[model samples]
Target: MGNNNGRKGPGRREILKSAGAVTATAALMSAVRASFPGGAFAQAAGPETDKVTLGFIALTDAAPLIIAKEKKIFDKYGITGANVAKQASWGTTRDNIVLGSASGGIDGAHILTPLPYLMSLGTVTAENKPTPMYILARLNYQCQGISVSNEFKGLDAKADASPLKEAFAKKKAAGKEVKCAMTFPGGTHDVWIRYWLAAAGIDPDKDVSTIVVPPAQMVANMKVGNMDAFCVGEPWNDQLVHQNIGYTACTTGEVWKDHPEKTLGMRADWVDKNPKAAMAVLMAVMEAQQWCEKMENKAEMANIIGKRQWFNVPPADIIDRIKGDIDYGDGRTVKGSDLLMKFWNGGVSYPYQSHELWFLTENQRWGKLPMDLDTKAIIGKVNREDLWRSAAKNIGAAEADVPKTTSRGKETFFDGKVFDPADPKAYLASLQIKKVA
Candidate 1:
């Protein structure tokens, strides 16, 4: 619905992404100037496109959508009629996609990773049946982090023990629940926080209580002590550091470097019905991703995305992180700006079946789903790789641009085990934490 950064949120990296979008657009404009020689700019020839609508939840990683719209990437791809609507929450975003509320009238949405999974495996509790959504492309990765309150700074557990041990000890010593929060259960943030905590020998179920709070409300809840710590996407984590209320204990990327963050999700039915429109949308977003990766465009990206109409936060706050600058506070900051976040760099944008399998395995491990479901079958039904491949090809994405043939990629879980997707059963069985199921 909204974002967590208190003062109009979009922190540093978002601003930089916005600037990059503009610079890319300017470069394209310059090409026109040289060729036209003071003549009128030629309108790109394509199908009549306008009034295309999309949805977002106001996170920093949503920058590419804003940048694309601002730079007319949609128009460039003949996708006019563009309107971006900020949904109330991830649930609402999910509901719209499932019920055909968003796609029935317009296009699709910038959705969370759990969406497709939930769609394939209905929310039995909610009695919601599978809606079968598909992702057009990936938006960004390695952008979320876990934040801890500054009040717990001096606790010896904070430094000497794992986060799980530290949180539990602090809570018991204070005679209060060491409450930790994440945006959603069965979502990437929750999975990372729980997996990370469990890796350090902390029982997420008993040692600490995990709660779900909306991203925009995380900082407020932490400020009022409604929660002790939270794992969320930028710029909320960055905002906490700046306010000195909290600090980044670990990045999701640290949990699994280059982990999936956000994606452009559409219903499978919608893709089947409007393949051309879907491909066009993918092309526009992919171009937007390329624009975001240009380092020189960082400043201009900040200016555009930091504006009142977009993320609407101070350009400085969003700039540092978007540019890959890290400020862990307590006198710690790093300038690995390239690590900030990325949108596109070829095959990195597709939704891999292996990625889905890892999430499914984690869900099963955490007791969110019953242990007997067929992981491969569910993944095949949910991933929609055929559609993604078509979109990628239409956009000129090469075969090598996609991820490895299998899910196996490089990962170093802080707990010390290296996960190889090729041997997932072994990876799941090797865990030392409680297996609720």
Candidate 2:
């Protein structure tokens, strides 16, 4: 990881500047201590490791981490210095989390929701060393999309794949295969695309090919005729539409409203060793998330993240989607939608156990995890809701903001499929397209 300026290392001046900043932050925290009651201020402590590095990909949802670093929110929370490093891909993010700080990689990252579980289970690890990871918080929700190339321009396939099945068949018969791409196998994007295809009786595995492509490269791959369609997070999806390479089939929110997407993932060892530091990071990011979810702050957020050091795309490409101004690039436009990326509001930041259960169940459905695995036990071990609650309490979060229970009950998908966390096995059996065995 590089310095905050994206340079190889910090200079002596940078170190001195960081120390002065921390001294100023301490003064500010002291001044605000008299406001909160019940010694809430006593519980908040400086991070064990004030200087730390975090990883992020080139996606809009990575805003909270970037904002926390850019706006000095981390410094205010006793994280004297923080570096937000750019990861090449989600796989690299996973690998870096596994390697951890000891190997000069990341301590944590903005990662896919299911990745922590998979990493904990050693399903997609480098050396099968099942790294114990914890979900600090969910970063954002419902800003991903499934996109198809211009070849499917005239297809009447909005939320239904029946019309596109024939094209896939024809292409196959003609000795050319239709392919779909997702950021990672068994990730949120893959699951969404799989669910969409399966809902219309088209098998993702049998009907067409599914391949892995990094989010940033998705539009380029589609442009070069490498894939027929792709499911990815913005601004790539929006970038594709802008570049006339592809059109939106449907937003992931249309598939599953307010779907959990990226998460703040950290190694369990790091959390245990630096419990106060972990809370500091969480508190700063929580504040940053609230700032990001505000409508007034979105444009500035877009400009900050769209810089060459961050997402490296035009601000306009990133701004429209954050404001819920959507263009499907096929003559369809949505003026505004409540289904845009939500960073803080609507309990979007809560690490719901039910959500993780759904992810585990999907992993099982796709043969990524065994169906007989103890989901409740695994979830309890992986999801640190206790830590989240503690952070919330220390930060003086609103009473309603803290959930009464970890379970969000049940969720209903766009295809009318219901997932009851209590009866995950039954839900698995009911799924028409799955490989539970």
What lDDT does each candidate get? Answer: 0.70, 0.86
Against the true structure, candidate 1 has what lDDT? 0.70
What is the Cα-based TM-score of model 2?
Answer: 0.90
Task: Let me know the TM-score candidate 1 reaches against the reference structure.
Answer: 0.82
How does each model score on TM-score? 0.82, 0.90
For candidate 1, the per-residue lDDT at 371 reads 76
Highest lDDT against the true fold, candidate: 2
- Residue 116 error for model 2, in Å? 0.5
Per-candidate clashes, comma-separated: 25, 0
